[model samples]
Target: MRIWSQCVKELAQFLRDRLTVALAFILPLLTLFIFGFAIRLEAKNIPVAVQDFDNSPLSRSYIERLYATNQLQSSRWDGIGSPQAALDQGIAKAAVIIPPEFSRRIKAGETSPVQVLVDGTDVNNARVIRSSIEATTRFFVRNSQLQTNPSLIQVRSRIWFNPGRQESLYIVPGTCAVILWIYPSLLSSIAMVREKEQGTIIQVYASSLSAEELILGKGLAYLIVGLGIAAVVISISVIIFGLRFAGDPTPFLISTPIFVASATMFGLMVGTRVPNVTTAVQAVATTGFLTALLLSGFIYPLSNIPFPLSLISNIIPTRYFIPIIRDGFVRGTGWLGVWFYLLMLMLLCLLLFNIARRNLSRMQLPD
Candidate 1:
């Protein structure tokens, strides 16, 4: 009954703390809006250089088709230099090289390979541009040969995992990871800070509640609160925002505790060191936002980052959780695909929780 009373009192106090309430409610919406605009895979307004060596109608029509896709916005060639110069100068993502005898080669039923020099700097974008170019060229070739052969093969392409490429689906899962990164800190930090600020932590310091019990109690309190917020966000993401949840909820259910535990311990560590509320908020915000945007596979894919940076990111809990969440939701991957990440998260949580408890137990208060 005493523990129940203490829990209820803490809940009420949590409700009354304006900063806590604001963080718990208002901040998630703000994140949703910011990230909704940032995570995009489809490229628009890509620049290219066209080298029309043949000076034929076929070449002109192909160039017009590239423009018609509405993907590349601007294209140019000085006609004084090779397409390689354009690519080297970063003036073009791709250059279309048409051979001088392209028309004659096609008429004679000879395959004259039209070289497409694509900038492979961004593998995904390069693939998109190259695919579009080849697709257009293939269509022209097929139609031209149809009169001679009388039979043409039709081609169809099926896109998996975000067929429409709606930014919402990608951003929502990333947003969930970002929220987990910051909210756990906000939840755990405030509770401990309030105790320190209000002169109540001293009672626990002098009592028989042991360092582990106090840490567990505080962590459990924040976990329940954090999960409530997570549930609200998930409901909003799925039902209100129309983001799909393709995989079993069990993965999320299994992994969230581990994520929250790591985040909570990290927050407790920060809370123990900070002197005021503003700094606490700032510490969590800076660490959380940077970790989510840079270290986690949210704004950039892990493979795209350099080798050393990628290794550093592995230590970040979100680095593990984001892939699992994305895989579970977007790819509909089963537990087998995500168990490794889940294990990493659990191990990190255990390590952090132990460290936080040790630190909290060591914090000295007035006798």
Candidate 2:
């Protein structure tokens, strides 16, 4: 009954607080809308330099095919000495060099290799450019040869996860991860700081309410709110953006509360250390936003990050949870595949809760 009353009190306070209301509801929606449009995984409108030395009809047709895909655009590089020079001058993201023998090799039924140079400054864009060019070239070759040779071998490819490679499908789950961490942590910490500002924390300390009870009460209130926010954002992703969940919801269902608890406790710990609401919000933002964005394998894979940084990512709770959400929703991995991450989330939740409890126990009343 006491815990329930505390939770109700926290809920009422959350409702009354404008900052908490904004953080809980408005901010998540705004972030979802912004990131939904901004973070695109698919590469589009990439400029490419074409050096068609062959001056053949086949070469011209191949260049047209590249443009038809809308992934690559031909860059104007009339004065460029070589495809490599065009790349050096940043005239294009990639360059295609078609040798003079390209058509002759095709006519003689011999394998002809085309030289492709890509600017590796952005590795992801470079990979996309290389893949798009290769796919276009293969399509051109297969179709062009089919007219003279009916028995030419043909290859078919299919993408299993995220077919058609929709960027929203890839980004929304990660955005959910980022939002979950930032908002719950920010709101929970601010709630604690608000208690200090209103001089209610001393009353809380003087009461018979245990630290665990206080923490659990505050955390439970935010947990329910966070889950509701997550559902709304996910529905927006599914209904509006057309994201589909491919796997069982059990893994995601099990991990979400654990993730939320960890985030809320992290905020509580921050609130205990910081003197005011502004400091707490800034702390939560810096810690939650940066870690979720950079270290959680959201934008970049942990495997690709350099040695010690990769080692450091292993400790971030979001690092484990992101895969759980991605696999359960996107890749459709069963429990056997995701059990490790689930266990890690549970352990992280325990650790964070323990630290927050200790911090709460040691909290000093404002002077």
Candidate 3:
């Protein structure tokens, strides 16, 4: 009961500290809100230009269908001007060029080539626009067929992991990984800095406690808080935001210890070197934010980045966790595919902990 009271008192004091409160609660929620709204992959409001040389009902109907697609916002240019002009000037994403012989070819039971000039600058959006155009064109061709015998060719599409392309499914899992990277690092770093700030670290080193044992205790404390943060985020994601949870708990269970251990070791290293809590916070923030943005395969696809940058990214531990959390949650992948990541995480923790322990054993505070 006495220990519990003391713990509660310390927690209260920690909470009352304005800076601690801001870092713990305000900044994290602010980041979550900003990133959730801004960093989406879904394309909207695709612009298209139409040049109808045939001026027939069939051609007009086809153009109408293109406008009807909610994904596309289309405009008509009634001139023989260059389709390349529309693409080059950024006036359109795609241009539909209906040749003069369109109606004549339809009447003769022949296929007329309707050229679609697409701006391939933004590849993903261009692909979606092209698909929508092709689908709409095929529909028009099928319905306008006046032949005695109708022929049809069916195309099938298969999407793995997320068939519906639900952005939340991909995003929520990736967000979970991002949260893991920052929260664990911040928590562990603060735990060490707090000990140093209170002048308890020297006594801890002077005592019989081994570096490994000290690290373990610190790891357990921060692990409890990290799990609490995960639970809160998960609850918000599932109950408030309606994100799905379709996978086994094995990945989450397995990754938590590795993440916490790595975080604790990193914190110890930072704490031992930086003189005060403020400097430690600065160090962690610089390391945490840049590492996540550049190295975690979140913003840019790892394969697309330059070879040298990719090599550097491979060394960031967060890179491993992002894929693991994403695969487990979105793809429902079992341990078979991601065991290598788990192993890598374990190795990182061991290496960092060894260095941190050595630093802690030799370090003395400056007067």
- Tell me, by lDDT, which candidate is best: 2
Give the TM-score of each candidate: 0.77, 0.87, 0.79
List per-prediction Cα lDDT, in the order shown: 0.78, 0.83, 0.73
Give per-residue CA lDDT, model 2, range 1-367, as digits (tens). Answer: 8878888999998888786687688889999989988887778889888888898988888888889977898787784487788788888889888899988887887877888899999988888988888888767866776345545665677999877778877788888888888888888898888888989999998888888888889988888788878888888878877777687889988898898888888888788778898899789878778988999989887878897778778778898888888887789976878899989888888888788888888874433
| Cα-based lDDT at residue 176, candidate 1 | 85
Off by over 4 Å in 1: 1-6, 47-57, 74-135, 146-167, 304-307, 365-367
lDDT per residue for candidate 3 within 1-367, as digits (tens), equals: 3334433544565557787656655555566656766677766678788888999988888788888867788644434578778788787888888999998888887878889988888888888888888887777766766444656866777998888777777677667667766776776777677888898888766766666666666665555556666666666667744665457768767886687667667777787678787888788888876777777787678887787777778667778887777776677676887888888888888887787777776764333
Whole-model alpha-carbon lDDT for candidate 2: 0.83
Assess candidate 2 and give its TM-score to the true structure.
0.87
Model 3 stretches with alpha carbons more than 4 Å out: 1-13, 16-18, 75-91, 131-154, 190-210, 275-279, 365-367
The stretch of ten residues in a row with the least summed lDDT in candidate 3 is: 1-10
The CA-based lDDT of model 1 is what?
Answer: 0.78
Identify the runs in model 2 with alpha carbons over 4 angstroms from their true place: 76-89, 99-115, 146-157, 364-367
